[model samples]
Target: MKLRIVHQTVYRYDRPVRNLVQSLRLTPSVFEGQRAHDWVIEVGGGIRGPGFRDGAGDWIEGWTVRGPTEEVTVAVTGRIETRDTAGVLRGHRELIHPLAYGRGTAATRADAALRELAASVTEAADSLDLAHRLSAAVSDAIAYAPGRTEFHTTAAEALAQGEGVCQDHAHALISVARLRGLPARYVSGYLQAAAAGEAHEAAHAWAEIHVDRLGWVGFDPANRCCPDERYVRLGSGLDASDAAPIRGIAAGQGAETLDVAVNVEDVERLQTQSQSQTQS
Candidate 1:
C-alpha cells in the first residue's frame, strides 16, 4: 500500500520570542516494511542546519528560527510505500545494542503494578510469545479512553487510572515489557484511519520489543494488533518525549499555544481524484 501524509503544527506565542531551535525526527524509517518518497520538512522563516542519522538509525535534522516573531509553523509532506512484515523491523541499520533500551525513562518507569502485570503473563512458549502476551496484558489493563491522561502521565499513573490514549498505552507496555526482562522502546509515527469519520489520531504511537532472534517487533496495544502496511514508522526512543517528531524550545519566556493537524490518505484515492480532474 502507498500513503500520502501531511502534518502541520503551528505555535503562537503570547509575546514575541527571541529565537527558537528544534530537533526533528520527522523522517520516515527505512526498513523492509516501508520506503519513503518525495518527503519534505519545512519550517517557516527558519534556517535548516545539519542533519544526521543517529545510533538508533533515526534521522534527526536541526532548524533555527531567529524570531522576534510571534508564531512559527512546521510542515511535513510525503509519500511512502509500505508492505506488511508482520511487525518485524527488518533491514534497518542501527548501532545501539538492544539491551540499551532496557533502561527506563521517567514516563516508562516500572512500578509494583507494572511488575505484577508483567508477571501475570508467564505461560508463554518463547520470547516472541512472551512479548505478545505482555502486550495483551497491557491492553486488558488499560482501556483506550482519550483525554483521560496528559502528556506527562507516567506508565504507573496511567495504569492506575485504567484509561488513556495511545501514548499512555505505549508507555505502559514499555514499562511492563522491561519488567519482564525484554527490551522495549516507544515508536512515533502515523496510522491511516481504517474508515471514514473514524475517531483515530493520525499521529500515533506504539511500543516495540526486541526478541532474541527478531531484532524489533512492534505492538499497538491500544488497537490490539501489530503494525501493518497502514502504519508508518518514524522513529523510536525510550519514551514519547524522546521519540517526539518535533522537539523545540524558544529562547524568550513567552507562553506558547499549539495547534496540530495531521492527515494520511491512500495514494490510490489521490490518483482517482487526479484522473477525475483530468477527465473534467
Candidate 2:
C-alpha cells in the first residue's frame, strides 16, 4: 500500500513568548514493513538543527524559534510505501535493550486494578497468546471515546473511567504487560482508515510487546487488532509523553493552546498497479 499523509500543528499563545525549542520524532520508522519517500518537515519561522537517530531507532530533529511570537506552526508531508508484516517489527536497528522497556513510567504504573487485570489473563498458553489476550482485555475495559480524557490522564485513571482515546489504550496495555513481566512500549504513528473516505482522529498511537521468537510485535487495543499496512509507525518509548511526535518548552508565562490536524489517504492507483504486478 502507498499512503500520503499531512499533519499540521499550531500552538497559539495568549501573550508573546520569549523563545521556544522543540524536539521532533515525526519521521517514519525504517523497518521491513514500511519505507518513507518524499518526506518533509517544516516549521514556520523556525530554525532547523541537526538530525540524528536515538537509541530507540527514532529520528530526532531540533527546532528553535527565537521571537516574541504569538503562534507557531509545524507541518509534515510525506508518502510511505508499506507492506503487511503481520505487526512483526523486523530489520529495524535500535540499541535499547528490550528489558529497558519493562521499567514503569508514572503514566503506566499498575495499581491494584491493573495488577488484577493482568492476573486475570494469566491462563494464556504462551507469551504471544497472553499479549493478544491482554490487548483484548484493554479494549473491553476502555471504550474508545474522544474528549473523555486529557493528555495527562494516566492508565489507571482511564481504566477507572472505562473510556479513552488511543493513547489511553496504549498506556493501559503497557501497564498490564509490565505487570505480567513482559516488556512493552508505546508507539506513535499515523493510521489510515480501513475504508475509503472514512474520517479518522488526529495522530494515532499503539503498543508493542517483545515476544520470545518474534521480537517486537505491535498491538492496538483501540482498534482490537495488530498493526498492518494501514499503520505508519514513527517512534516508540515507555509511554505516550516519551514518544510524543512533538515535545517543546516555551519561555514566558503565556498560556498555550494547541490545534492539530492529520490526514492519511491511500494512493489508489499506485496500490492497484502494485497489486496487479504482484498477481501477474
Question: Residue-wise lDDT of candidate 1 within 1-280, one digit each (tens)?
Answer: 8999999999999999967999999999989999999999999999999999999999999999998989999999999999999999999999999999999989998889988898889889998999999999999999988788989999999999899989999999999889889999999999986323363545999999999888799999988889999899999999999999999988888899989899998889789999999999
lDDT of each: 0.92, 0.93
Give me the runs in candidate 2 sitting further than 4 Å from their true place.
194-197, 269-280
TM-scores vs. true structure, each candidate: 0.95, 0.94
Error of model 1, residue 47, in angstroms: 0.4
What is the number of backbone collisions in each predicted candidate, taken in the order shown? Answer: 0, 0
- State candidate 2's TM-score: 0.94
Q: Pick the candidate with the highest TM-score.
A: 1
Candidate 1 whole-model C-alpha lDDT, 0 to 1: 0.92
Query: Residue-wise lDDT of candidate 2 within 61-125, one digit each (tens)?
Result: 99999988999999999999999899999999999999999999999998899888888886788
- What lDDT does model 2 reach? 0.93
Q: Residue 144 in candidate 2 has what lDDT?
A: 90
TM-score of 1: 0.95
Lowest lDDT sum, 10 consecutive residues, model 2, at 193-202
